[model samples]
Target: MPRRHVKLHARPPQEVQGEAVDVLVRRGLDDLRRELDVPPSFPPDVLAEAADVVRRGPSGSRVDATDVPFVTIDPEGSKDLDQAVHIGRLGDGFRVQYAIADVAAWVQAGGAIDDEARRRVETLYAPDGRTPLHPPSLSEGAASLLPDQVAPALLWTIDLDAAGAPVQVGVHRASVRSRSQLTYTGAQAAIDDGSAGETLQLLREVGLLRQAAERARGGITLPTPEQVVEQGADGVWTLGSRATLPVEEWNAQISLLTGMCAARLMLDGKVGILRTLPDADPRDVQRLRLSAHALGVPWPDGATPGDVIRDLDAANPRHAALLTDATSLLRGAAYVAFDGELPAFTMHAAIAAPYAHTTAPLRRLVDRFVGETCLALSAGTPVPDWVRDALPELPGLMSAGDKHAAELERGCLDLVEAALLTGREGQVFEGAIVDVRADRDEGVVQLRDPAVRGRIEGAGLPLGEDVRVRVVEASVPQRTVRFALADDQADSASA
Candidate 1:
C-alpha cells in the first residue's frame, strides 16, 4: 500500500518557480472559505442590547474603577479591551494586578446577550475583518476598558516574591477606570530606553519578573514567529513577521498566573474544567531525542519533559520550534466538567499544573464561564446551576470553536502568503525546517520563514532548526509553498 504523500519537498530555483504556482494556492483558500462556513453578519439587536448592558451599571455588584490607574494594552485599532494591568514594587517583590472585563454583569443568564454570545460561541477574525461575538456597541464600546470609563471588572491581585513566583493570589469583582490604552510597540520602545512612563515601567517590571519565574521553573518557551498581513497602498496584501514584544509575553505570564490559580481552586473542590495535555508519547520523544543529538543538544536522562524542551530550545531554535508539534500531542485540550471525581489527567504540560481558560472573556466564551465559576467559588457561594449545567456542553462547543479558529486563520494565512510571493515565485527566502517525515511515498518538509510558516516536500535531510532553504515554488491556488535544499545547508525537520 502506498503511504499518503505528506511533504511537498523544496526544490532548486530553476525547476519550479513562476506565475503557475500563484494560481494553485489561491484556489485552495477559496475551497477553505466555502467549507468553513464563515459568517457574514450578526443580528443587530444583539449588539444594541450588549451596549445597553455595558452602559447600565450592574445593580448586583459594587464597582469603582477609579484610583487603580488601570491601563489597557492591545493591538492598534482593537476595541474589545478584555484586560487591564497595573504593577508596583512592594517590600522585596512586586504587586501585580490584572483587571479583566466583568462581562458577566452584562450577559445575564437566558438574556438576549447570552443567547447571541452562545450562538456565536467565539469571535472569528478574518483577513478582511472580524465577526465579533458581541455587538460592537458592547465589545468595542461600553464593555471595553476605554480610558477614564468606570467599567466592571474581575480583578486579580497577585503578590510575587523576589523571584517573581506568586506568593499570594486574590480574586474579586469591582468597578474600575483605565488610565490609558497602550500598544505593545509603544510599551516595547519605552522599555528599550529609560523614557518609559510610570505605567509602562510597571508593566515591564511585571513582565520581567514573570519571565524569570518561568525560566526558573524550567518552562518550555518557543519563538513562534507569525506573519502579520497588512494591506498596502493599492489594497494588496503584504506579509511581515509580527514582533513579539517583551510586554506581550509578560502579559501572558500574568494571565497564566490567574488561570493557574483558578484551576487550583476548581481542582481542590473536585470539579470543573481542567485544561490538560498528557505527557508526550515515547515514540515522538525518541524522535526528538535523536534530533536533539544531531543538533548537539543534550537531553539529560531523567529530565522532565519541560526541562528537555527548554534545553533543546536553547541549543537549537529550529528543533525547539519542532517541539511545539509534539507539545500539543500530549493530549487535546479538554474542558472536563465533571461532578465529583477529578479525572486522572489534570496537568497542563506548558504550565506544569492544572489550568483552565479564565481570561479574555470578550473574545472566548469558555473563559466567561470559568470566570463566573471562579467568582462564585471565591465568594463561598454555591456554583450557579446554569453555569454548571452549561459545563457538559462546553467541551464540544470549545472544540468546534478551536477548529474553526484554526481553519479561518490558516485560510487567511494562505491568502497572505500567496499574495506576498505571487510576484516573486522563484525568489529564495531564509527558512528553517520545522518537520521531516518519510514513511513511504514522498519525504515531507515543513519550513518556517520569518514572515510565514508552511510545509513543503523533502526527505533524508537534517531535520533541525536554522537549516536554510530557498523558496522553490509558491502556488496560490493550492495554498502551498514548496522548498528544497540549497547550497548543502543542513535543515532541522520536526515530525
Candidate 2:
C-alpha cells in the first residue's frame, strides 16, 4: 500500500459549461444496469402480495407500545424508515427502547414476496435512485415506521449500566408509533442548542457512553470523508467531499448496540448468522506502518493500528491516502451461518466484537431473517423451519449482493469523474502516487482539484510523492481517465 495524491475540490460553475453531465449519468446508469443484470422492477406476484398486505394492514399477535414516544433519525428525505428509538435515564443506568420494522410479519415465508427478497438480497443504491429490495408499497408505506403511524415492529428493550455495558436485553413483536421523524442534522442542532426534548438529550448521553465503550474495546473507526455528487437547481452536477458528522456517529452507536445484542442472542442460542471479519493481518499492518512513515505520519510506539487511524485528520491528503491503503487490512469480511454449532471465528474486527445485522430490514434482506431468529430465541420458542433451512444459503446470496453493490458504487463514481473531466485533457495538475503496478510502467494517482483518481502512464513514478501530471485522456463512453507525468518533471527526476 502506498499514498497517492488526490484532488479535493469541485470545479467552479463558470468553468463547467455546455456538456450535460446528467445525460451522461443517465446513460452510465443504463450501462451499469445492463452490465450488472439489475432487475427492472419487482415481479408481478411480489407486487400483488405487497398490495394485498398494504390493504390488510398488520396481522398476527402484537404487544402495543404506542404509548412510547419514539422518534426516528436518518438522512434527510429518507422514507423507508426502519428503526425508531426512545432513550431514558433510569436510577443508575439507561433504558433503550429500539423498535425495528417487522418486515417478516408482512412477508410470509415461502411466499412471493419472500422469494423475491431472497433473490434481491439487499437494496441497491445509486446517485440517481435506488433498486429497492422490497416493493415500495410495503417497505415505504406499510412496513415503514413513519411518524404517527402504528407499525408492526420487533421491539428491543436493552438496559445498560453506567459504563454502557448491556445489563439486560428483551425482544418481542409489538405495535409501535413514532412521535416524530428527525434528521441527523436536526437532532444534532437540538442537542447543541439545548432545545432537545428529554428523549433526544438522553440519546446524546447514552450515545457518548456507548462510543466510549467501543473505543475502549479497540474498535476501529475509519475517518474516510464521503465524496458526494450533487445536482444544482440549474441541473449541473458538482462533486465534493463531506466529513462524517458527530450526530451520525452517535445515532449509529444505537444501531450497533442493538446489533451486538442480537449477536449475543444468536450465539447463546447456537443458531444464526454473524457478520465476521478476521483480525488485521500482521503483514498488511506492517505495510501500512511503512506507508505512514512514507507519508510523514506518526505511528507512536505500542499504538495499535486502530489507535493510530482513529486520530488521523481526514482533511490531510496523506492521511486520506493512508486510509485508502489501509483497506488491505480489512479484507475477507463474510457472513457466517450455523444452526447447532458455533462458528470458530465470530468477531467483526472493525467492531472488535461479535455483530449481526438485525436492524434495517426495510433496506437489507438479512436483517429480516436475523430478526426472526432473535425473536424466536427471545420468546423461548423453536426457530422457524424456513429460517433454519435458509441459514446455509444466506452466506453465498449475501456475498453476491455485496459484490454487486460495491461495483455499482465504484462504477457510478468512475462515470461521474469521466463526465466532469471530459474537456480538461492535457491540463497539468498536482497529484500524489497512491499505488503502482509491480510489473508495469503505470500507477494510480489522485489529483487535487475535482478530487479525481486515475492511472498515470510513466516509468519510475515515485510512490507516496507529490508530482505534476497532465491529464492524457478523459473518455466518457469508456468511463476512463488517464494521465502522464509532465515531460520536464519526468526528465528532471530521471536526471
Q: Estimate each model's TM-score.
A: 0.83, 0.94
lDDT tens per residue, model 2, 202-261: 887888888788888888888776666666666666666666567778889999999999
State the TM-score for model 2: 0.94
Worst 10 residues of 2 by lDDT: 1-10
C-alpha lDDT score of every prediction, in listed order: 0.69, 0.86
- Model 1 misplaced stretches (Cα beyond 4 Å): 1-34, 54-59, 197-199, 298-305, 311-331, 422-430, 440-452, 465-477, 483-495
Judging by lDDT against the true structure, name the best candidate: 2
Total backbone collisions for each predicted model: 38, 11
lDDT tens per residue, model 1, 1-495: 011112222322221245333333344545666778765666676766665676675546655647888888888878899999888888888888888887887788888888877777889876657878777776887777888888888888888887777788767788889988888778777777888777578666766777666766656565444556555344444455553666787778878888888897787766677677656577867776676676666678877556665434312355544564445445655667765788877887666667899888889888888887887777778788888888888888888888888878887886656545555555566655555565632233433433556555566555555656666666566666666665455243333
